[model samples]
Target: PPRKNSGVLADAMENMATFAALLRKEMNAHEDNDHEYRKLEIWTRGLISSLDELEQSWFAAAFYRKSVIAGFMDDMSPVEQGDYARYVYFYKDGFIRVFSLLDKLGTVLNHFYDLKTSKLKTHFSYFTVLRQLQLLNVHPALADQLEQIKNSYRDPLENLRKRRNAEIHYMNSEMQDDLWQRHQGLHDKIQLEDLDSHLEDLKQSLEMNCKTLIAAFSYSNEQLRKEISKPKSVQS
Candidate 1:
C-alpha cells in the first residue's frame, strides 16, 4: 500500500503554529485582551487537530479504495464489501470534516475581526463569514485571497457540499448516487460510484481548505504583529 503525504497539511500546520505563538505573545502584552487571545489560541489548536484527523480519514479512504476491486455490489466478495464500506465511511468523514474545519476557522475569524456574522444569521457558515468580510469592507486582502481559493476549487467544493448535505439531511451519499442510477434503469447489480474520482474531488476540497486556513491565519498574524509593534502613549 502506498502512503500519502500532504504538503498542504505541513504548510497549514506551520502557519497555524505561528499564529498560535503570536496570540500567546500578544496575550501577555495586552492583558485586557488576554481572555480573547486565549480563546483564539484554543480554537487554533483545535483546528490543527481537526486537520490531522481529516488527513487521516482521507488517507484511510484512499487506502481502502485501492483494496476495492469490484465494480458492482453484486460482484463484491465479502472482504471487498468490507473494504468498500470502510472507504465510504472514511471518505464521508473526510468531506464532512472539511466543512467542519472551515466553520471552526470562521468562528475564530468572526471573533478576531469583529465581523458580527451572528447578527445576520444565528448559525452562520464559513461562506457567510466570507460574505460578512466583504460586506463590512474589512480585511479585503484576506477576503479576496480566500475568495479566489474558493473559486479555484468551486466545482469540487460544490460536489463535496452536495454529498455532505445528502449524508447529513437525507440518505447515505453513495446510496443517493445509486438511487439516481436506478432511476436510469433497473439493473441486475448496483454499480459503484467512481471511487477514484470522488476521492480526487475530496482531495481537492482538502487542499482548498488548507489554503484557506493558511491565508487567513497568515493575514491575521501579520495584523497582530503590526498591532503589537505599535508604540503606546505615555501617561502624564
Candidate 2:
C-alpha cells in the first residue's frame, strides 16, 4: 500500500478517460499557425497512444494472471511444467509493461515541460523529468502531486527497475546471481521461484504505473483546458 493514499488510483483512472475526451475536444475546437498546430497535434496523439498502450498492458496482465491461476490447478499432472512457464511469462509481461509505461510517461513529461533544450543525447528517464519539474517550480501543485507518486512508487520501482535493466542490458532477470548461490548450498535443493511474491510485486508496479499516468495526464489536461478556456485576447 502507498503510504500517502489508497483511493487515488481509482480516481486517476476515471480522470484519464475524461481527460482524453477534453483533449480531443480542445484539439478540434481551434486552429493555429501550421507549425504550432502540427506540433500540438503530434504531442496530443502521442499522449493518446501512450494511454491506450498502458490500458492494453493492464488488460493483458489480467489475462495472463488468469492463465497463471488456472495453470497451477493440477499440481502433480504433466501440466505443471506449463504452469511454471506461464508463471515466468506473467512476470516478464508485467515487468516489460511497467517499464514501457514509465518510458511513455517520460516522453510526455519531457515534451510538455520542454525539458530537452539541447542537442545532447540524454535518456529521458522518469526520474530525470521529476527532478526537472522540481527545478522548474512553475507548477507547484503538479510538482507536489508527482512527489507523492514518486514516494509511493519508490520501493517497488527500485526492484522493478533493476530487473528491467537486467532484462534489457544483460541477461534474463530470472537467472539472478543470488538464485545461483542458493542452488550451490549444501542441500543443493532446487525450488520453484515464489510466484506469489512476484505476483504481489507486479500488482504493486501496475497500480503505481496507473497512478503516475493519471497524475501526469490530469495535470496536462488542466493546463490545456486553461488555455482553451482563456479569452482569445488572453490566448494571444
Candidate 3:
C-alpha cells in the first residue's frame, strides 16, 4: 500500500501516468475508425502532450530547488547580492514553468469546448472555459466535478495569475512585486523574498494543475467511452 499524500510532485507524477494509460487505451480502441473519433482523439492527444510537459516542468523545478539547497554557499545570506540573484533565478524559473503548464492546460480545455469559434472570442481563458462548462446545460456531473476543482484552487490560481500576467506583460514577476513593496522610499530596506515560499507556491500550483487535469480528462474519457459504445444511429 502507498501513502496517499506521499507529496504533491509525486502525486502529480502518478496521476499523469494513470491519465496517459487511460488515454492510450481509449485511443487504441478507436484506432481503426479514425474518422469517427478523430477530433476527440486529437483533443485527447493534445491534453496528454500538455500533461507530459507539465510533468517535465515540475521535475525540472524540483531539481532546481534541490540544486539550490545543496550547491549554494552555506553561509550565503538571502539578502546578499550574490545569493539573492541565485534565489531569484530559480524562483522565477519555477513560477514561470507552473504558469506555462496552467496556460497549456487552459488551451486544451478551450479547444475541447470549441470556445475559439464562438462569437465571444474574448472569453477564452481557463476561467472562461470553466464558466462555459457551467452554462453547457449538459454534462452536469462533469461540470460539477470541474467546478469543485476550480473552487479548490480559486485563491492560489488567482495569485499565480496576477504574477503570471505581470511576468508576461510587464516585467519579471518578482521584480514587479518588489517594486511595489519597495515604493515607500525605503532604501536598504528591500526585503528579499524567501525561496522556500516561492517553491511552495509553485508546488501548490502544480498540484492544482494536476488535480484539474485528472478531473477534466477523467470526465472526457468517460464521455468518449460512452460516445464510442453507442449504437450507430445514436452516434450521429
Candidate 4:
C-alpha cells in the first residue's frame, strides 16, 4: 500500500524485489505513518493508479487502431482496400504507429498536402473526406488550406468523391468499377503509370494526411498556448 510512479513501474521484471518482503515492508511502513503521511500516501496512490490506467488506455488505443486496419484490409479486396476510406484509415493508423502519437485530423491533412507526385494521376476525391474533416472543428483558414490542398489537381473528382462517400457512409453497392468514366461530368482518366506505384502514392498521401492534420493542430495549439501564457493586465 505504498505510493509509486507508474512511469517508474516500467516493464523491467528485475526491478521488483520478491513479493513477500515487499508486502511486509509496506505493512511496516504504513504503521509508521501519521495523518499527513496517510494523506500523502493517498494522493501518491491515486496519481500512480491514474497513470497506470492512462498507460493501459494509451497502449489499448494503439492496439485498437492496428486491429481495425488489419481487419479492414483483410475484409476487402486488395484493390477495394486501396480505395479512399480504408486506405485513409490504414495510413492514418500507420502514422500513429510510426510517430507514436496523433492529433485528430492534423496528421490527415498533412499527408494530403505533402503529396507531390506527378508520375501518375494527381487527382483525389477528397471533398467528402474534407467535409467530414471540416466537422472536426477546422477554422475558416484551415478549411481554406484544406480546400487549397484538395484543389491542386487539374480535374475535380466531385463525382468520384460523391460515389466514394456514398459507398463508405451509405453502404451503396452500385458504385462499381469504371462507373465514373460513364458519367458526363467526369473525364475519369488516369495516367499510364503502373497501378502499383499509384496505389503506393495513395497510401503515402494518406499517411501524410495524418501528419498534416497534426501540423495544423500544432499551429492552432501554439496560438492558443501563446494566449494562455500571455501576462494578465493588473487589476485597477
Q: What is the TM-score of each candidate against the true structure?
A: 0.93, 0.75, 0.69, 0.29
lDDT against the true structure, per candidate, is: 0.91, 0.64, 0.60, 0.37
Q: How much is 215 displaced in model 2, in angstroms?
A: 1.9
Error of 2 at 113 (Å): 2.8
- Model 3 C-alpha RMSD vs. true structure (Å) is 5.4
lDDT of 3 by residue, 1-236 (tens): 43233454454445545544555665675453644244544555555555555555545555545534332233445545454565566556556666565555566666555555244555355666666667764667867887887688777667767777887899988776468666865463545455566666666776787777677666665665575567644354
lDDT by residue (tens digit), candidate 2, 48-163: 55545544544454454544433223343455556556556657766777776677667667766676622233766677677777777877788789889778867877787788
TM-score of 2: 0.75
Candidate 4 Cα lDDT to native: 0.37
For each candidate, C-alpha RMSD in Å? 2.4, 5.6, 5.4, 17.6
Candidates ranked, most accurate by lDDT first: 1, 2, 3, 4
Ranked by TM-score from best down, the candidates are 1, 2, 3, 4
Which model scores highest in TM-score? 1
Model 4, range 1-236, lDDT digits (tens) per residue?
44343332332111222222332344454453344323333433332333334344333333333323333223544654445344344433332332222222322332433322222234432343455456554455666665664555313223333434555576542334335434643554421112233234333433333333333444444443454356655557
Q: Look at candidate 2 and tell me the lDDT of residue 51.
A: 44
TM-score for candidate 1, residues paired by index? 0.93
lDDT of 4 at 101: 22
